[model samples]
Target chain A: MEGLWALISDDLPALQIAVPLLAATLCVLIRRPTAAWAVAMVVAWSSFANAGVLLHRVLTTGTISYVEGGWPVPWGIELRIDLLNALVLLVVTGICAIVLLAAPRSIDAEIPRDKQYLFYAVYLLCMTGLAGMTVTGDAFNIFVFLEISSLSSYALVSQGRTPRALTAAIQYLVMGTIGGTFILLGIGMLYMVTGTLNIVDLANQLALVGPNRTVMVAAACIAMGVGIKLAVFPLHIWLPNAYTYAPAIVTAFIAATSTKVAYYVLVRFAFSIFRINQTFDGAHSSAIAMMLGIAAMFAGSLVAIYQDDVKRMLAYSSVAQIGYMILGLSFANEYGLTGGLVHLFNHAIMKCGLFLVLACVLLRMGSTRLSAFAGLGRRMPLTFAAFVLGGLSLVGVPLTVGFVSKWYLVLGALEAGLWPVAVLILLSSILALVYIWRVVEVGYFKAPPEGADAITEAPFSMLLPTWILIGSTLVFGVWTSLSVGVASAAARMLIGGGS
Target chain B: MIEWGLYNYWVVIFLMMTGLYVVIARGNLIKKIIGLNIFQVSVIMFYVSMGKVRGGTAPIEAAGFEVYSNPLPHVLMLTAIVVGVATSALALALVVRIKETYGTIEEDEIRRIEADEDAS
Candidate 1:
């Protein structure tokens, strides 16, 4: 057993990517929905376990570097996982695994059975891309993985029942392609100047080069490119429609993982690779990020308040949640960066749980409209209870993960001597309250339409996963050692690397 | 004095902007995709041009040849071209489905139809 464990541990990085990718191909070949789902489920759980092991290894031994094909680091592609990506890897894979546990039931309702196998296959491929992006230390390899994930998501989004899904997918495709191209161009420019595609090497070379116009341009291009993917306020137009019209499981999975991964990339580019202050003329970039994040917080929350569709409201809320993460990043201090990174994990758990609640509602009622949620609190007690708990977390009430993340963010803001930013963070939590309360009122206070009594709770299969994530909101909220502890370590590493 | 040797970059910028403009201005899905293609091609051209040396042949082993154009960018761009092609193919496929379902591939028309559906 020890020998077997040793063998698996040696190839963890390669296995993280290859398992899903190869399984995705197997899913396509299987061509049976149940079989494909089983394959995807097994792969998701294994990847989750693999991510857990990788994070453990990183925490114990520090960064793990794997050189592909036994080639040298500067020339061959490398997979590097420091604390930052190890934390992100856990979030991505953990969310994927939990969401997949609830997927089969939700997927059955939204997608035609004939195409369900294709759905699972594409889902695994998307997972492959996201995991690859997290693990790769090569500059060009990030682009490759970004495209893999983007293309698969486009395909997944278009699988929705409504025709609007197609439009959403196309818009996302165009914007996403533009974003990918910008990244490609930036990588090309960096290669032109530094002649290396290794991220660490590029960072070292960039520091030595010291503020060339080409490097500045490269940084700007990569920032904007990742900004598009990150959906940082102005670039978030494609998000709402895509989420609103997508299949429930797709919306949950992507909402939980994709933007978080994109934000990880943004963190990497800003802190790890370009060293934000040095690249952007000192503190100007932070001001820009702060402004955008502030705008996103208010604008996203205000927009969410008016959305009649519950899924659309949550999607807009995702925009605002992304703001909190970015706001954490803008502070660039250890506490602030920890807030951002911890929010990445906290938000993934809560938001995914909330979406899973929607999936349960959709499974039973055929809709996620506000009107459909009337008296759902009485009928689907477990699911709506999950929603309320998740909503409380979103509102940053004490004893919830949301509160944990927000506390750190506020602490970070105060530490940075930006008391106004702290006040604004509190104010935005009120906005979150207004939107979440809107749903609560609809779910609890409003009367069910006539003859709505037959509505039942979501299946155990679905509710188990929903509550697992919802339960973790409280679990991690009280036990900050796992989320906040790892996050601060990652934040310190980033700050140390940057300086 | 302007460096005439840097003419390739000028072409790249022009093509890139033109492609971006078309992608933004065109309402037709197919045209938008074509614009995206143009935009991608500009980047590809930029990378390919960067790899070229002043007096280099294709990267190959020969007794007399000393200088060879860098093959890395060319190889990288090969992967990029494949990605670009995949993107276009997927975009075109989505366009086909949109046309079939919405009965029009024009962005305005699709929006109008969706807005009508939402109202009812």
Candidate 2:
């Protein structure tokens, strides 16, 4: 067993990507939904296990850098994992595994049986791309993986029941393509000056190059490009519709994982590649990020309150939640960065769990409209109970994952002496409360729609995964050792001990 | 004064702006996709142009060749081109489906149809 483990440990990085990619190809050939689902299940869980092992290795032995095909650094593609990406990898793959466990049932109710195999195939490809993006250390390689995941996502979005899904996917494609091109342009400019595509090499060379016009333009291009992918406020036009119209499983997976990965990229670039002091004429980047975050928080929460469609409401709320993460990042201190990083994990679990609840509701009710949820708390007791827990987490109630992150955020703001920003953080929580209360009021207080007594609880398959996520919100909230500990460590690494 | 020798950049900027303009200005789905392709082509050109070295030959190994054009950007651009084509193909496919279901590919018409659906 020790010998086998030794052999596998060395190649964990490659296997992390290879497993899903190979399994996706196999899924295409299998052509049976159940068989494809089984393939996906095994692949997702194994990748999750792979990420677990990788994270443990990173935590123990420090960063892991694996060169592709036995080439040297600055020439070969590297899959590098430090504390930050390790946490992100675990969040992404772990959420994917749990969501996949609950996916087959919802998928059956929504997608046609004939195309189910294709759906699984594309889903695995999307996972492969996301995992690849998280692991790679090459600049151009990130773009390749970004497109791979994005193309599959566009296809996945179009799989929704209504014709609007097609329009939404197209809009996403256009905006996403422009965003991608801007990134490429930025990388091209970086290469023009630095002459290296490797991230660490670029960072070193950028420091040597100092503040130059070309690098400044490159930084702006990359920021805006990643901002679009991150769905940061003004660039977030494509998100709500895309999430609103996508099939339930696709929405859940993308909502939880994709933005977090994009946030990882932004952080990687902002701090790791271009040090915070060097970006955008020195110190303005943080100011810009803080301003946009505040705007998104207020705007997104206000818009979410008015959305009658529950899924769309959650989508808008996602925009607001992204604000909190960016707000934490803009603080540029240890506590602020830690708050941001932990919120990444916490939000992933909270939002994915909430969406899973909606998926259960969608599977039974055939809609996620506000009216459809009337008296749903009584009819689907287990599912709505899960919803209430997830909702409380969203509102940052005590003893939930949401509050832990917000606490750190508030502390970070106070430490930074940005009292108004701290107050704004608290103010936004009330907005979250208002929107969540709207749903609760409709779900519990209103009478059931006529002849709706036949609705039963979601199948155990769905409820189990939903509760597992909801339960973790409380578990991690109370026991902050793992989540908060790793996050602060990662924060220290990103800030490089200055704080 | 602008250096005319850097004319490749001028062309790149021109194409990029034109492409972006069309993508934003045109309402037809196919036109939008065409604009996207054009925009991608400009980036591809930008990369390819950057690979060129003064007084250099192709990146083939041979005796007496002191300077060779960098081959990496060309290779990376090849990948980008393929991604662009894939995106265009997918966008066009979506347009076809849109036509099939909604019977119009104009953005305004589709929005009108959807708004009506939302209302009723």
Candidate 3:
């Protein structure tokens, strides 16, 4: 019985991916849209519980590596879970459940009734792909699941009524294709240099080879490829449009989960897939990261201030937020990694609440224009209140989730003696405050748009999840232990340091 | 042996850059898709080139065969082709939708429309 339990625990990682995937296919057959949504919600929460328990198990223990059918490394596929993936897995599932719970009423207003059932099904498949990408150790498995998620996301984004959404989806498809292709090329390079599919085996073999030309090329390709996916600075051309034109729920889900998962993959690749000592010596490494982080921070915030649309503004802010995460990694130290990881978790809560609130506003006002939000605080007080809190978090205001991440990041930058970066971070937060306050001012102070009376609150279903996450920003802000605790350990684990 | 050290990689790099340049610089929608196709095919060539071992035959069940071209990159390129094709098909389908909506297939035209819409 004990042995069987261990075997079952070993299978948990794969099941977490496979269960939702199988349910998604079954959901298509359930003709009733309500039933499909019910099934998707249950699956999301179940995955969340599974991920939660798995995270707890790993936190208590250490890394868990389960080879397919009990095969050892270098011979079979592996599902590897350390603190890093476990944390991301929980965030993915948790966000998915919250978004799905709030999806119905939002969809009723924005999406036509006929498309509702299929929407939930596609959402589940996209969630499965994200979970699979997080949980797997095989490089090729990443590509396969990446295509699954990308295809579904295109469908979801283009589901928007605006014809411009089609163009946005096309651009994302084009850029995502190139990104995926470059990753394939990089993985092929690694395979040529080291004849193993298992990540641990590849790492061990790579250490023996050191940094050769092929390995360098692979590193370059992988970095560039994933930089595009995570929407890192200059490579982030596709994100604002995709997020802006996408369906509200789609934006909410992708905002909270998609790019963060890519960041997790980047960490896994940088830390585990290719060990540190071998990687840190790359020429132009620090320069590229620092250059791009500064660019993204300054450019993303400045551009965000010019946006009339709330969703696009938040998307630019995301680019800047990712800059902070990358800046943290540029330090390549324990504290640096901790700051990045903590920010990843904090940004998820803050951004998700912000997007969901935008969804709420869109439901009532039929647009996310800055002008339309004027005096919104009076009409839909709770929804706008959530935005203010979330915005405050985005601007790194004291006692919010964003403040915690920035504080730790500042400490980390100081530890690294990159005082300039510390200054840039502070400056960017002020820039963020400028954009965020622009929205807050319009929402609270400006007079309501003409013919804008009879506006009301987002339905209970929608507001419920929005407030839940908004409340979490406050909860996590004060506690610090949930994000900072996991992030510190996860960061240490990421940089191959003592956990 | 000299051929192995020289032209094998140069050709691959040249072709890859050519493809990438087209994707970045071209304005026509179909041309851009064609450029993407070229970009993908060039990468496949790079992988195939890397997999080649001098004087090696295909890996087949045989006796006393000491050398074989690496089959792994070849295998990966197959999947890459499938993904590439899927992307192309979806992209073209979207272009069709764009043509329907805006009645144009030119990248610059599409941009002008989007800009004009945003300005309004």
Candidate 4:
């Protein structure tokens, strides 16, 4: 009850998680679609409001930690609101607001009317799960919320009203389970060495057991687990089909937020939660980081160039973008870490905008095939414009957010004297241009096949969100202050600060 | 024949890896689920095994005991078991759906369908 009042007192972190969870259960009891949506809207708005306040609080006062049930961590569950978690909280909650507002229409169209209320309930549940995972400081709590999200995600994807969606959900389920198991195993490894589940305590205890081979193996296991969850390169086999067959709104949410959260976990582990002890006894860490990251970059981009379906191409591109984030991380420098952080937020926006545009096109064109988008530039100018803005960001065009990320990345590579890596980054951008231009050429130059009638542009519900992100992509491109400042501060909190 | 804190961990690690390899190598979908079950159980085993302290009984507080198997990891693992159950249920549901759609539970056949899907 006190935790409940703490939320009422504007503690922010509790409100961020509790609002959606309580609202989700209440929504289920209501059993009315409109009422469910109203509740979900309130919950999402509150979550977003709470996230913004939390970000400001973290920026002003450093990390704000609350011990749930009034028990301190290592003995009880805790929530830590730091710059990193707050940034993620804003992105997650912000997307939830848009997805929820946009959901009723798409959900009714794709899902049966009878099942619409369940859809909202599950989506909100998944939102609560994702938010809880980010806010919680306990390793085991991460797993709990991770499962909640994955479980609901499978149900959401399976509600695609196509048989293929079932298969996609199965593949995702198998891989997600494996990933979760690996993470749990790694957490177990840490607990065996340190005897604590609190992330802060685990980091402190890691120093005494720093030299053990088990610790190194634990790191590798954790990396691989997060890698799979993020669909990093080779582990990305389930991605294309899953995104392709899923409900478009489901694709938009998962593509935007899911892998990025896992990527945050990986960065949290390697950079903040465990980096302190490594510097004293220079562990051979950089080698593994380089090996996995560069491989993901090279392999993911190459695969993306060959996909014919628009959604598949975008899915492969997700892997390539994840590669860039991972590559920046492997640089293990201040600039590299900042670039990585910037790319995380940038990728979320650009990818969601890109996928939302595709969702709009899917609504009109009846397929996501590149051939169908012929002359879309003329027919649906706004959608195509949003697509182009997103594509330009994808290709790292100058004076865009993508360019800012690449500029910092190239600097980091040069700082490390990794000239070859700088070249690979350039090459990957070319590959991105190739795939993006495939659609551009089809839309602008190619003629629509005979009997294909002009279709209406996607509704304002869809177009507005795409444009908001497109405008932000341009705004952030010129206004590097926000992106660069937050990223550098976050990098310090990750790499230099002990916590 | 009793050993120290380190010995207890070795057996758990060995079982965990063995389960992990089975999940990696197996191709049948149901068998993969079983492999995953073993894998998740191994993780639970590892965590619960770690919670054991030397000369500790169950974690409930009795007046005279100096050692208590850490209560936190145990509570956490109980939650994890619930997570594992949810994962298995979702996995099984997906498998059922895949079987209904593709008419095959073997992963190779599913891959063939996916490849066919891309080609067409």
Which residue runs does candidate 3 get wrong by more than 4 Å? A1-9, A276-283, A497-499, B1-11, B52-69
**What is the TM-score (0 to 1) of candidate 1?**
0.99
Residue-level lDDT of model 1, residues A1-499, one tens digit each, is 8999888878999998999999999998999999999999999998999999999998899899999999999999999998899989999999989999898889888798888899999999999999999999999999999999999999999988788789999999999999999999999999999999999999998888877899889988998899889899999998998999888889999999999999999999889888874455748888889999999999999999999999999999999999999999999898999999999999999999999999999989999999999988899989999999999999999999999999999999999999999999999999999999999998899888998888888999999999999999999999999899999999988888741
Best of the two (2, 4) by TM-score: 2
Using TM-score, rank the candidates from best to worst.
1, 2, 3, 4
DockQ of each: 0.91, 0.92, 0.63, 0.70
Q: Sort candidate 3 into its docking category.
A: medium
Output the better candidate (1/2) by lDDT. Answer: 1
TM-score of each: 0.99, 0.98, 0.94, 0.94
Fnat scores for every prediction: 0.86, 0.86, 0.57, 0.86
Compute the DockQ of candidate 3. Answer: 0.63
What candidate 1 gets wrong by more than 4 Å, as runs, is A1-3, A278-280
Q: How does model 3 score by TM-score?
A: 0.94
Worst 10 residues of 1 chain A by lDDT: A276-285
Q: Residue-wise lDDT of candidate 4 within A306-416, one digit each (tens)?
A: 887888889888888888888788887778888888888888888888888888888888788888799999888899989998999999999788998998888889877
- Candidates' lDDT values, in order? 0.93, 0.92, 0.86, 0.81
Better of 1 and 4 by DockQ: 1
Candidate 2 lDDT over A296-340, as tens digits, reads 999999999999999999999999999999999999888998999
Candidate with best lDDT: 1
Give the runs in model 2 whose Cα sits over 4 Å from its true position.
Answer: A1-4, A278-280, A497-499
> How well does model 3 score by local distance difference test?
0.86
Residue A27 of model 4, lDDT score = 81
Per-residue alpha-carbon lDDT of candidate 3 for residues A293-313, written as tens digits (9 for 90 to 100): 789999999999999898899
